[model samples]
Target: MTQNLGGILLIRMTSLGDIILTLPAIRAIRQHFPLHRVTMLTSLEYIDLVSEIPYLDEIITLDRRGKEPAETIRVVRQLRQKKFDLVIDLHGKFRTRLLSGLSGGRQRIGSRRDIYPPNTHAIDDHFQLLSTIGIQANDKSLEFYVTEANQCFAQELLNEKLLLGDQVKVGIFPGARWDYKCWPADRFAEVADRIGKQYNAAILLFGGPAEADLVSQVRDSMQADPILFDTNLQIGQLAALISFCDQFVSNDTGPTHIAVALGIPTIVLFGATNHLKFGPLDPMHTVIRHGNSLDRSKGNDMMRLITTDEVWKIAEGKLNSLDK
Candidate 1:
């Protein structure tokens, strides 16, 4: 079959949560143009996870967190060589703008100007780059692709940790990249304790290496018949592990999105972010937001304010529904 477009380069190069959220739009694009070669520009750490997505023809990984200007230049040069037919700046940052300018694509699609104050829901502001091209984005729902390898890994991990005939596995994502998005680790431990004791479920602490400390803290704080699965694994492995859980409770982070996409009952704790805009869309998912709507600051200020009981109730409700 002939394709309308030669090739497309989509740039979304930051934040685990935001990158995961773009999958729905990516799926839409593939459905809209089946013959187009849809490539992605993302961080090196996420290469394994993104590669599992069948829609992506190729993935160009970069180390965007590096501060050196030469690093950006290196990626820009590589992008220029690809000579893509179109460049879509989904990230909409200044660096992405510069890269798109140098991409040598015939058409560059980007957002309108955004001058919002800091601490706003960055997702909406990023989409402003689409104004000039008349591409209006109404939804921010996330989608992910999990392979059978992931499922088998999850089961193996669970079986290794749990005795036969006791298949109760629960997931707890205890870390957030942004300080403001993280609830207190103790609160998570409290929830884990309750879930473990009441349901006889084993808690799996989920996060990358950066979260090992926080995960350890939560595991240590647990008081009620504590049994936890804490591992420093790759994102694909983490996703696989989460697939084995009966339910997942996490802060506003990437792994939570992955759990929801896998059709696992997930509870997302939202503190500094706006729930109206960035909440998960799955029927089995629950989002607990702070009562205050105008407090848009980042860090633990808002996250720390969420009461333990509030999260506990939401989590229990989801668990009950999932069990039924």
Candidate 2:
């Protein structure tokens, strides 16, 4: 709670969406401690993603997948050398907790999920941690900074694909990290076809290399020809491309949160997950859940329960609202 605190180290190791959700809190920390040296410790895979965020003074990334023991020791030594005055562990995992303890910070704070009610949004949960340090984060808005160069990259790709113009662009991401969280690909194609026919929107299919087959399935099943973006793109490139979309449709995945952070109008499909906790909180975004209850045991069946008509109706409403 002291204003004269030295270096502050914040840790959130892995997973893109979770890291994206923590941005508001990070911004709040920067605002609260403008004079202090604030550094973020994240996984190496997300360095490209977190690097663009202007809130942190420094970023330290670890190759979490490669060289396990050696990387851990190296990171521990690095943290100790920095001699952080305060260590805030946004990630409550054992590894982060251990690092926080070994960082030699005089004050240490870890996230306490029990302090808040069930189904609290991750952003609010993070703010609750900040409250412990007398840092009140009243403005909890997610942010992703896309540099002009990356924006130019996205524009060039759109121009090369002849996807430029005033026509509405709809981005469809038909892949989820978990199988149970994905709606059927055929259903996505049907929705894309309907949107293309009704709104005459340019369909932009997006996916990582791992989801190329899934993205292809949706594109192949669609009657309309969609611009494919299935190649491996850097996080900034992906965010820049997504920024061009007028409307985005995606499963429960990291890119969904990225779209939300970029202020795009997004429709997220959720299954076997707590939409209340992780779904977009802004009014511009829509979340369509499969069932009345949160039942992880239902598995992929929960996602299948979501009909094409259901999603189409919401998408129609959103597109119509855009006209107003």
Candidate 3:
């Protein structure tokens, strides 16, 4: 097949949730240009997760969090060498802006300009970029490729923790990157206990090393015994574990997005964030918002306004539906 374009470099050097949400549009771009190799320029920690994106031909990683000067120069130099045909900046941040300029692609597309479109989801923001180039982004589902090895690892960890039963495995992620976005850990524990007792389900706490303290807060507060997923599993393995969840309840965070992509009935607790823009893609999934919208300045206390009972009802409804 004669290639229409040399290659495409997609820049999305953001944190977990945003990066995961960008997948569908990225996939659309790859599908639009089947013959061209689609590459993603992302953070080093995200390399494993992005690698699972079958549509992407290659992944370029950088330590964006650490701000490594030499690494940036090396990556930038290599990107210039690749002589990309198109560069898409989904992050729309300063670093991605710089990369978009240095990419040397014939056409450079970015998600945002001076202001965003009046009302749109964050995912659509990426799709809007494709429209400019006459490509309609028809696919809007989140994508995550889980390997057999990763699945096996997840099962083994579950078994080791004695969570390999027919009982429902409710995965809970209590921490979000930002304080404003995180619901209280104690409330999550209360929800876990309610679900565990009401349905005879096993609570599964999912988080990283950084989230261990937060995880502890939830676990210790809970009356129910939860299988703590605080191990050093690779990003792929962690997602694989999430796949086993019957229903996931979480703060507005990356793992919540992962659970939603896996087709799990996920209930997201939203307060500081806008539910209209960042809520679940599917109607089947739930997002319990505060009575009113709040800004970051409103503080995390607003999240507490989202009652445990209200979220419990939504979660129980999902679990009951699963039984039916």
Among these predictions, the greatest lDDT belongs to: 2
Q: How do the residues 1-324 of candidate 3 rate in per-residue lDDT, one tens digit apiece?
A: 224778889998867778888888877877778888888899898888887888888999888666788888989898999999888898888878988898788878887745676457877777777788777887788877899999998888889888756879899988887888888888899999999999889888877657888888988999877888754668788899999889999988888888888888899888777776777779889988766655687748778788888998899888989863
Those runs of model 2 whose alpha carbons end farther than 4 Å from true positions after fitting are: 292-295
TM-score for model 1? 0.85
Tens-digit lDDT track for model 2 on 119-145? 888889999999999999988788888
For residues 107-219, could you state the per-residue lDDT of candidate 1 as single tens digits? 88864335544444445555454444444555655556667786677677667765444556788888877767888989999988888877777777766667778877887
In candidate 1, the residue pairs with backbone N, CA or C atoms under 3 Å apart (3 or more residues apart, or in different chains) clash, namely: 110-129, 111-128, 111-129, 111-130, 112-128, 112-129, 180-299
TM-score of each: 0.85, 0.97, 0.94
In candidate 2, residue 292 scores what lDDT?
58
Instruction: List the candidate numbers ranked by TM-score, top first.
Output: 2, 3, 1
lDDT of 2 at 105: 88
lDDT of 1: 0.73
